[model samples]
Target chain A: MRRLYELLEQDTRTAGLTRVAVSTVAVLVVWQLVSMVVTNRLLLVPPAEVAVALVKEVETGAMWTNAVATVTAVTTSFVVSVAIGIAVGLALASSQALSLTAGPVLGALNSVPIIALAPLFISWLGLGFASKFVLVIMVAVFPVVVTTEAGLRATDRQLVEAARSFNATRLQIFTTVTFPYALPFIVSGIRVAWARALVGIVVAEFFGSFAGFGFAILAASQTFDTARVLGYVIMLGAMGLIGSVLFAALERRLAPWRQE
Target chain B: MSTAVRLKIEAIDKVFKRRDKPSIEALRNIDMEVAEGEFVSIVGASGSGKSTLLRIIDGLITPSGGRVLVDGRPVDRPGPDRAVVFQQDSLLPWKTVIDNVAYGLTLARVPKADAHRTAQRFIDVAGLHGFEHHYPHQLSGGMRQRVNVARALAVNPKILLLDEPFAALDAQTREIMQAELLSIWQETRKTVLLITHQIDEAVFLSDRVIVFSARPGTVREEIRVDLPRPRDLHVKRSPEFSGLVDHIWTLIEAEVRAGLRQG
Candidate 1:
C-alpha cells in the first residue's frame, strides 16, 4: 500500500489518472447501492446491467448504425456552419459601416435560445437531416461570429501600421497580419462552438430525427429500458468528451505561442 | 556627404481637433531638409510631437498644412522609398525571425525563395543567426528590435526612420544597440533620421542633431557634431563628445522650462 501511494504521488499525470479512476469507481459503487435500494428496474439499473445492455446494443449493430447517423449529421453541420460563420464574420469585419449595422442584429439573433427556432427549422427545412443541419448551424454560427469579429477587430494596430509603412497593400496586410493574428481566437471560438454543435444535433435529433444517439435515448426511455437509456447517455457523454479533447489538442498544436 | 536632398519638409503644420475639446497644435512650421546619406537625429522633451514629425516624413500621416517631398515628389502615402522602426518592436508575433525579415521584400513581390535568401544576409548582419525559425515572442526585447531593424533595412529604402528604437532597452543593451546601428549604417551608407531624448545617443550617432521646442514642436537648434569617423566606445570618454552632449542638454533644459512656464 505504501508503494502504491508513492507511485501515485510520483508524477502529476499518474496522480491525475489515479484520482480519476478512484472517483469513477467510487461513483459506480454509490450508483449500485442506490439501484439495489430502489428495486424498480424501470427507473434505475445497476452499472453492471447498463454495461451488459450496452454490449447487447453494440452486438446487435444498432449502436453503430445510430452512431454513424449522428456522426454524419454532426460532421456535415459543423463544416457548413463554420464556413458560413467565417464568410459572414469576414464580411462584417471588413467594413466599419457593415459591422456597425449587422453586428447588433447578429448579437440579437444569437441571444434568442436556439431551441426556440427548432419548430421553424422543422417547418422550413422539413423534419429530417435538413432540419438537424439547420439547427446545428444555428447553434454553432453565433459563437463563431462573435469570436471572429472580436478577433479581427482586436488585431494589433501597431502591427498593421508597421505593415502599411512598408507599402503593403490592404489585401497583403489582411493575409499576412490580420488573418494570422485572428487565427488563434478563431480556433478557440470553434472549440466553444464544437460543443454547441453537438448539443444542437442531439436536441434536433431528440425532437424529430429518424436516428441518432438522442433518438436512441428517447426510444429506450419510452420502453422504460433504463439500462439502454443509461448506456446511450454514457455514449453521448463520451462523444462530447472526445470532441473536447480533439479541439484542445488542435488548439495546442496550432497556437503554441499562446501555451506559455 | 551627398549634396542631393533626399527629404524636404516644407513648412509642415499639424493640429489635432477633437469633439468639444480645445484644438491642439502639435507641430508648427516644421521646415527642414535632410541630405542623402546624412545621419540626423531629432531631440526633444516628451509631448514635443517629435514622433508626429517623423510620421509625417514617413507619409504615415498627412500634416494639416504644407507637405513633405521625397526624391522630388510629394509623399501622399507610405511607399518603399522610406521605412520606419518604431519604439516598440512591431515585429509580427506570428512570424519567425527570418519570415519577419523577409516580409518587406515579399510585399514588394519578391519571389519567396529569393526573399528568404536575401533575408538571411540581413539576419546575419543583425546578429540573429541561429534564431531564424524562432518567433518574436520567443526572443528577448533587444533581439526583437534587431529583427525590426533587419526588416526595415531588408527593403533597401533611401532612408531609415527610427523613433526611439533603443529607448525600451536597458542602458547596457541600448549602448550595444547604438554601436550596432552605427556599424550597420557604416556598411549600408543609408541616410537616417533618428528621434530620441537621450543626449548622449544623439551626440554619439548623428552628423547633425536637430532640437525641437516643446508643444507645437519646431526646430530650436541644429548642432553639428564634428567628431571623427569610425569612433567607438572610447569616443564617449573624450571631452569633445561630452561637451556637445552637455550643450544639447542645456538647450533642452531651457525648452522644458519654457514649456513649464507656459503652463
Candidate 2:
C-alpha cells in the first residue's frame, strides 16, 4: 500500500528528465498547431521554422559570437557575485548585530525590482560590457548573500562543538565543519545567482549593446523575423535547463551525504 | 605519581537564566575526582546534568562557579588534552571516516601525510578499516559512533569524555559498541569519563559509577564495580554485575520519582 501510494502521489521529482522531455514535446505540438492556424508569416512561427532559422543562424556563425559575448558577460558577473556574496554572507552570519541591522537593508535593496534599474545602470556606465557586468552582479549577488547567510547559520551546533573540543581554532572550525556543512546550500544559491545573472545580462543587452543574444532577439524582431526570435528564446531556455542540471550535479558531488 | 588524580571537578555549578522565566539550576556544586587511567561513568535520570558535567570537563561550557582542573591546571577552554565522543550526529556528514578521524590532527598542524597515517591506525582500531572512504551518512549508527571514538582517539588525548555515546544505537548494536569501547579502553587505558543513563552500561564498563539527583543535579552516590578486567557480554549476566546495576537503578529511581512529584 505504501508503494502504491508513493506511485500515485504524482511526485514529478522522481520522474526526472522524462518529465522535462514530455513537457517540451507537449509545448512544441501546441506551438505547431497554433502557428499552422495563424496563417500570417509575421505573427507566430512553427517549431519547424524556428529550428530551420536556428540552424541557418548558427551556420552563418553570427550566433556563436553573440552566444560567446552573452556567456562571457554572465559568467564573469556570476564569478564576481559569488566571491563578494559569500564574503558578505559570512560577515553577516558571523555577527548578530551586523546581520540584524544590515540584513533588512539588504532585503529592501533586493526587493527593488532589478529591471527598473537596468536603464539607470546603462546610462551611468554607457553601452559597453561594463554596464551589463554591473547590472548582472547587482541582480545575482543578493540571493547568494541571503542563501549563504541562512546556510552558514544552519551549521550543526554539535559538529561545531565537536570541532571546538578537539581544540580547532576559529578558522579551522570554519573550514573543516561550518563551511563544508553549508556547501549544499551555497551551491543552490550559486545556481539561483547564475540564472539571475543571465536575465540581467539579457535585459542590459536589450536596452543598450547590439552584441549578445538579447541583441539577436531585438534585431530579429525589428525585421519581423519571428522564427529567429523564437530560436533565441529556445537558446535561453536550453541554457537555463543545462545550468540547472549542472548545479544539481555539482551539489551532489560536493555533498554526497545528501544523496541518500 | 601513577595514582594521582587525572581530573578534578571542584565545587562546579551551572545555572541557566531565561529572560521571562526564573533561572533554572542545571548543576549544583558538583565535585568529583577521577584517578589516572580509570574508567568513570556518570549516570542519572533525565535533566540530571550528566551531559552538562561532561561538557564542563571537556571545557565546552564554563561553570557558573568553580572550575575543572586537569593535572593541577585549570581548563579555561577546549583543548587537545581532552577529546569528546558525543551521543549522535557528531561526525561531520561531509567527511569520510578517515578524513573525520584526521580532522583533529590536521587542526594541530600535522602535515597531511602524517595525519592520514595516524588516522588510519585509529580507523583500524575502531573496526572501520574497510569503510575508510565512506561518508558518515553511509555508515550505520554503530559504525558512526565507532568513527566518533576513532576521531577522539586519533588526537591521543590524556582524557576521553563520552556523552551517552551509545544512547542512539539499537539494543544489539549498543551491547556490541559497549564491548568495543571496553576493549578500546583496555588497549589505550586513557583516563575515561563517560556520561550515560543506562545503569547496566554504567555497571558493565566503569570502575566507579557516580549517580546524580534529578534537575539541580548533585551527586547522590558513587558505587564501585569490582568486576574483572577485559569484560565481555557474558559477564553482564553475573550476579555481582546485576547487583551493582540494581543499586544504581534504585538510586536513580528515587530521583525520578521525586522529579515526577514536583512536575
> Which portions of model 2 show Cα errors greater than 4 Å?
A1-30, B260-263
Report lDDT (Cα) of residue B68, candidate 1: 90
Local distance difference test scores for all models: 0.89, 0.90
Q: Taking the tens digit of each residue's C-alpha lDDT, what string does model 2 give over A111-142?
A: 78787799999999999799999999999999
Quality class of the docking in candidate 1, CAPRI style: medium
CA error at residue A191 for candidate 1, angstroms: 1.2
Poorest 10 consecutive residues of model 1 chain B by lDDT?
A: B254-263
TM-score of chain A of 2: 0.90
CAPRI rating of model 2 = medium
Q: What is each model's TM-score for chain A?
A: 0.87, 0.90
Per-residue error (Å), model 1, residue A101:
3.0
DockQ, all candidates in order: 0.67, 0.77
Question: Compared with the true structure, what per-residue lDDT tens digits does model 1 show for residues B1-263?
Answer: 87999989999999989899998899999989889999999999877899999998888888999989887899888888899998996988778899999999999999999999999999999999999999988988899999999999999899899999999999999999999999999999999999998989999999999999887788899999999999787899999999999898888897777767777
Q: Per model, how many backbone clashes are there? A: 0, 0
